[model samples]
Target: MALDLEGYLIDVERARGLEDIQTLILHLRDQYGVDHIVYHWVSSDGEQYGCGTYSPEWAQRYVDKDYLRVDPVVIGCFQRFHPVDWRKLDWSSKAARAFQAEARDYGVGRQGFSIPVRGPNGQFALLTVSHDCDDEAWDAFTLAHQRELILIAHYFNLKALELEHARAPEPIKSLSPREVDTLTFLAMGYSRGQVADMLSISEHTLRAYIESARFKLNAANTTHAITRAITEGLIVVGGTSRAADGGWPGRRTPS
Candidate 1:
């Protein structure tokens, strides 16, 4: 039987390192009655890393042959944010077909599902479950556990992020009231001129505040700035504080 996801989330949170997470996925795979569970992440620095239940030989072979370039799952999942069923992806290319053959030859499962996850600073990861079952059986399994699988995927990502930061600790930077205001409005889809009007600042000044926030967040661009801000809780846009400084990470005086 699989571990209870409610209790499992606490285990995920208390996971002290990557190894603990790896063990958890093994337990989760048993819980879901799937053959394998995998988590793969790509960092902003272009570093690729993750853990999974795939056999050691196959995992190494995938890396040694650079299968990532030809793997349909990696290619298709990268383009979307939602959970994907393997049957729906395109596998028409010669290279893709050959890779699929090799994967199956290596004992990879015949049925698969993947969830794409995105996080701060251009980080991306995938949580996948695969098994060797008939189409109808796979469909029933996915339909039954879809919501819990999604929740597990996110919590796993969060713990992974926390562990990474613990190893390479970066101090959380604070944003100013005006900078928070600029990002909040921008995240709401406001144009620069519109944000300027709302903040009672000139477009020139608006640009400065955005640049400052971008620098503080170490974001690559304005869109990245807004994404990073929201992820880090420096500015909460969609939730409570739909408009202004109420969502800023900390209290700040008027600038």
Candidate 2:
């Protein structure tokens, strides 16, 4: 079945709970003619939330085995700010190969694309689509849908934040000047080392600033903190509007 992307997005935006997210992924799987579509997130405070089309048995087994510690997708995506093709991730390790084989046996697909999303307070997540298809076919599909998929990922992240806020509203914290500078450089695509040099700060000092900012923003990681800062208008980047008048709290925001 052809995916009515326009309609699907409406459904996505209308989703009211985690269960609704699961149902939407099921619909997306069928429409994309894919084996699965998944969105999984881990919050800064250690809460986990996810919705996907993978079979419950496989999902359970994965948890029971603690495969995440060795899952190449998780590891690879955590270090990246861009979308990734599964084939590009490391699979040379024996453990990874074994895991991949088992996943395939459980109906996982051979071709996949994942987008990593980082949210405030160290929250991390991945949005993924997978399919069983020849390499050429998979490539073509991704080429055609890449932009749409990216948009979907961003919407999912934003909606997830809204849901989180609804469940527990908190005060909004403003980033410190140093934190703002660090995140701005990062969002602009500067490498950590480059940023460190540009700021005339040692790498260690830079890391300290980043970690402090992450804590203040309640972010799950540096990238998440940066995203949160931008979204909340703690810092201006590239002429983007500072639409956020406020945001979530942990530390403090200047009035």
Top-scoring candidate (TM-score): 1
Candidate 1 C-alpha lDDT tens digits along 162-243: 9888888685588887898889889888899998999898999999999999999999999999898777777777753434
Off by over 4 Å in 2: 44-47, 171-255
Tens-digit per-residue lDDT, 1-255, candidate 2: 566778888888998988888888887777788889999786654456678988899889887887777789988988786989999999999999999999999988898899998877677888999889999999999998888888788778888888988988786566666777888888889999999999899999999999999998899988888888776668667743243343334433456
Clashes of each: 1, 13
| Native-referenced Cα lDDT, model 2 | 0.83
**What CA RMSD would candidate 1 show?**
12.4
Against the correct fold, how does model 2 do in TM-score?
0.64
lDDT of residue 168 for candidate 2: 83
Candidate 2 weakest ten by summed lDDT: 239-248
What is the lDDT, from 0 to 100, of the residue 54 in candidate 2? 86
lDDT of 1: 0.85
